[model samples]
Target: MDKRLFKEWESCVKCGICRSVCPVFKEEKSEPYVARGHITLLSELIKGNIDFSEKEAKDYLYKCLLCTTCVESCPNDSHTDTIVEIARHEVIKKHGLPTYKKILSKLLKSRQAMDFAFKSASTFSPIFAKKNNKPRDGIKLRIEVAGKDRLLPPIAKQTFLDKYGNDKKSRVVLFPGCLINYTYTEIGDAFVNILKKLKIDFSVPKKQLCCGAPIYFAGNFEDARYLAEKNIELFLSLNAEHIVVLEPTCASMIKLDYPKLFMYFEDKKWEEKARRVAEKIIDPIKFLFDQTDVLRRLKKLPIRTTYHDPCHLKRALKVKDEPREFLKAISDYTEMKEADRCCGNGGTFSIDYRETSLKIASRKVKNILDTKSEYLATSCSACIMQLADILNLKDHKEIKVYHLLELIDKALEA
Candidate 1:
């Protein structure tokens, strides 16, 4: 019942407009799974009209994907996603986080822990991970976890961070999140290749850690803030003009969540640093697209492709046109149905709520299939992972899933 979030909850007015656009509601067909229902529940709790046990509140709060569909469609422009985040923080503060979240928080809170876990996974990957090295697919390894296959972009022998140190001459700082640094190093490489092509001098900060999106969404706000502060300090020390991220979710987290996270604290100093860092955060596609002559250098690719809008890329950042405009310039770009719909891969959401995540992702796969395109492209690494999993598990391997950066790099080579 934080006052700021309570105010946002009060603004809902029980309108069902968010229900129409919510991907979870479409799959669950339950009021509890939609934004309106959550707002009503929060309103009731704050007004003393309803009572929920600690477990009950946790249930309602954790069910959300925080994809911002309702936030985008609300008539009053209610901040549903931020409200949901605060609600989760409140619940976790009262009842404590689930075991999985505790583990995730520990790993994400420290770069050393993340590196150790990834390196250990890489050592055992050959036995546990299956390779998918196709040109268009971002899923590099399909590893068996708890008897179910979990998708991961392959880890590099030499991490991007390990390969490059602080460069005083660079104008840009590349913040490779855990995925790009450990799991999908090729995406990091693709980014590096594209930066070289653009003649943009960028440095990969060796001290950069996880973007804390996972921990923040899972209600571990304290740890997320600590990570954010560490990142903010690290990047500011680099004295770079622009801070670029390989993953759209990372960019969204740094740009949006970092400032919001700082709001809960009385310390104004960190908020100022977060705001400065936020101002420098840029999406790679949007940054590259600004270089008009570089776009003209891309060869016309002959392959037919369609785009899947990552929720963070589209809803969080309002980046609907930049990636598309870039794709249309170099390839036969086809628009998929409900391109901006959530693919239900809210990082840990897919792992915690597999059935619902899969159901939503299946529909997205169907939309991709309907376009009859050879490849499906998106800007977020999480969306790429989920779409690749749903596409493969559903026996639609003929269609490859790719990051927009990957395609851009390929077009440069072509």
Candidate 2:
């Protein structure tokens, strides 16, 4: 009921520019799915005119991707996404997370649990999930994942940390989010390979936990506060000059959200620690791009590549140009339409709202196809997975998807 939440919401002049830009609104074709409609509803909820616990109201609340596009596009800085975050936290505080979310929150907070679950799922994939020979290149699934396609990069039995997290003495800390850690271990390999070529010594601490974005954005603030402690303490203890995060979502969570999380609770000690950690957080792309002669070292590729902007990297962190500059040097690069649009992954949002997620993704696929590029490159692991899956579903499986680090590694080898 605070006035600040209403500050942005009440100021909306009913402009539908948000509808024009929202991937969800474009797909859903409903005002309720757009920022303007959400603002009206949220203002009412904040004022107690509407009950968030209503089943209809509850479903609509979670319908958002928290893509931050509308907030970024808002002329008055309406910050509808921020209101959604606060609303989700309020929902959790009132009725508690669903049973699945509780399980997810627990897993996200515990590295051991995440390691077990992902490793177990990797083990189970061969047994329960159907696989084809061209798994990475987009194989179809009978299980119907993420709307209709169950395609995902094969999970790694050996987590990146399990294999390479022991280089604990280096000046740089490599923080791979859950996807790069478990599902996309090869991305970690690529970063290490590139780092070795750049002669930049780094460490991947085995003790680092989830960046807590998954559960935190899912409405569990308590567990995120706990995770902030473990990760912040561990990173600060190493005295590493830089903490390079693989996934942009993790980077945004640690760099932007963690400080707010601590400040919200008025935990000054932890807030300071959070700020210290935030100071160290850097995108892996920026970290590498900042190095001397990085462009000179990479061998330019003849392969045509296009880039998709992950929402967190493009919007949350305002990281727009560095990746493009690096890519142009390494590959035959062309720009995709709406490069900064969401791939509809939104972590659990894609899982919980599969149909809408895939619909939004389908539009993205059309834009990608228009580029007619041989490869799609991006910074975020989640976007890599989501874009790859959607591309496969659309039968453009031959168009390979890769982490920008992987492309850099390929260039390094050349």
Candidate 3:
């Protein structure tokens, strides 16, 4: 961790100005859990005045959604995400990770383990999916996680890479991320189809692992760094001109987080390679828009859709307009109020703080419902999962949630 960055981040005024813009604080109604409050605690830790073993400091770091909203809204332009990340790194270094997080990080770093997990999820999906009485009930089903209801999309019968394996098209490498490869392979299929339609050559790297966003958020920086090194080596071997990633979180990790984390890599060439590879990182929706002929072809879908900008994509990476423009080219695109507001699925935050996460997602669902559009399109898989669950719990079945690439693929098919 950079001590200078950590020190500057500790100087937040605790002004509460960011409270109104923070989705987590808005939902939880807790000042200590907000960005300003987290910075205050981090300041204490930085000063060596607080210990990580204390529940107050530990909970303060863990409670943050890491949505980056406060940073975006900060009058001083303080980088809150980096502050939280450094605090998290410090906490993990002191107290170590939880059992589940250790297991998750291990699975994430191992390609074989991830493949097996996806295969198992696809195998057992029918056990969780049941028939219901609504119009889209057959298409959607619920799963219970830690006593909270979650609406899970059925796993695709064939995984994305399996169907597209061995095809050497345009020579680009695909990063499907955990959720897309395991639960929502159809999104991956849509990405592949869109790339194919555009005649962009791409390949799915056989040894791809998790992009490490989950592990990074879980305060396991050691494992996260390991996964980053592994992915950097693998992508370097592929020699693709660009890395097309379907998940915004994964793309953000490769494009932004990794470079920051590996700034002082052992091999100067490795650092250079990682930076060069990061330059080619493109979200699937943005990649599709860059194809002019494809954009012209996409101007034909006749459906009404609204976009929800994922906080990571919109704020962390400043990619708010690309997905919107891509959707506009395909459909009657409507911008919902608070389009940049978070959907409250801050990876493990949704799992650890269920009630708070649900409250945040409820606001997002309300915003989408206000638009009254048929579909709510977003670029992040986790956001899609949380939004779908929130809408289902409200019994709003008419509103469909799709990845931006999925909508684009539908338009091309039409």
Candidate 4:
């Protein structure tokens, strides 16, 4: 942890300005869960004024969604996300990860294990669907902690990496995040098709792990750093000029979090490797937009879609225009009110604070509905899942949620 960065973050005035703009704070109306309060807590920790029993520290650190909205809103640009991550790292160093988190992180470390689980789930999915009378297209797997009724997208039959393998023609290394790989292979397939059409050489590494955002947000920074190191090595081995990531959260972790976390490495070569990896990281939409002839081809599609800017993509990366431009090319696109607002699905934040998450997503859904869009498109896989779950519950079946690349790919196919 950079002591100077931590000190800067510790000096927040708690002026409540962050609360005024924070979606989570807006929904909950609570300081404890707001960015300012989180910084104040870290301030106390840094000053040696309070001891965080493992549970207390874990709980506080886990409350953050790491959406980067607060950073955008802060006058000082206090780097709340960095401070939170550092606090999480400290906690994990002091106390080992919880049992469930440890298991999940372990599973996330192996693509083979993730693939096996997805295949198994896909095989049994039909049987379970028949027994429960749930439509195969819309299956809700109940995870107890997040809430039993939380609807999950069904697992894909084959991961994108499995289907495409590592083609030498592919100059870029694409990291299809866990959700995009296992739950929304259509999005992954669409991305591949677009890449093919653009003739952008790309490779999907066989051993890529979860970008580790979930574990990191859950206060398991040891696992997060471990996954980061593994991923850094994997990308370096690929020897690709660039790394393209489908999920905004994963991209943010690679481009922002990994370098920050690994900056203090004693080995200069490892630190240099981390920096090189960060440079090559590109969000899928921006990459697609840069290849504009693809967009020119997309301009002929007949469908209409509206976009939801995932907070990570919009506020964190400032990638607000690329998705809009991509959508405009293909369809009669409508910009929803508050298009860049947080969908409240802050990875595990939705699980940790259900009501608040839903409140924010509910507002987002209302805006999507108001647009009368045939499809609601976003760049983040987790945003798609969260918005879909909310829309499903509200019986808003007419509007579909999809990744932007899926829409672009469909246009190309037409």
The TM-scores of all predictions, comma-separated, are: 0.93, 0.93, 0.91, 0.91
lDDT of 3: 0.75
Candidate with maximal lDDT = 2
Residue 53, candidate 3: C-alpha displacement in angstroms = 3.1
**Clash pairs detected, candidate 4:** 170-201, 170-202, 171-201, 171-202
Q: What is the lDDT of every predicted structure here?
A: 0.79, 0.82, 0.75, 0.77
Question: Which wins on TM-score, candidate 1 or candidate 4?
Answer: 1
Better by lDDT, candidate 4 or 2: 2
Instruction: Point out where model 2 deviates above 4 Å.
Output: 1-13, 133-147
The candidate 4 region of ten consecutive residues with least summed lDDT is: 129-138
lDDT of 3 by residue, 1-414 (tens): 444465456557667888888776776688777878777777777677877674664678888878888888788777777777877877787778777888888888887787787678667766765643231222333556633556555565666666665535345778888778766788898887877777767788766778999988776767888888888887777777778888888998899888767652344555576788798788776766664467777655777889988877887667778787778888888899988888878888887888888888887777787887898888887887788778887888788777888888888844
Model 1 clashing residue pairs (backbone)? none
RMSD of model 4 against the true structure: 2.7
Worst 10 residues of 2 by lDDT: 132-141
* Candidate 1 Cα lDDT to native: 0.79
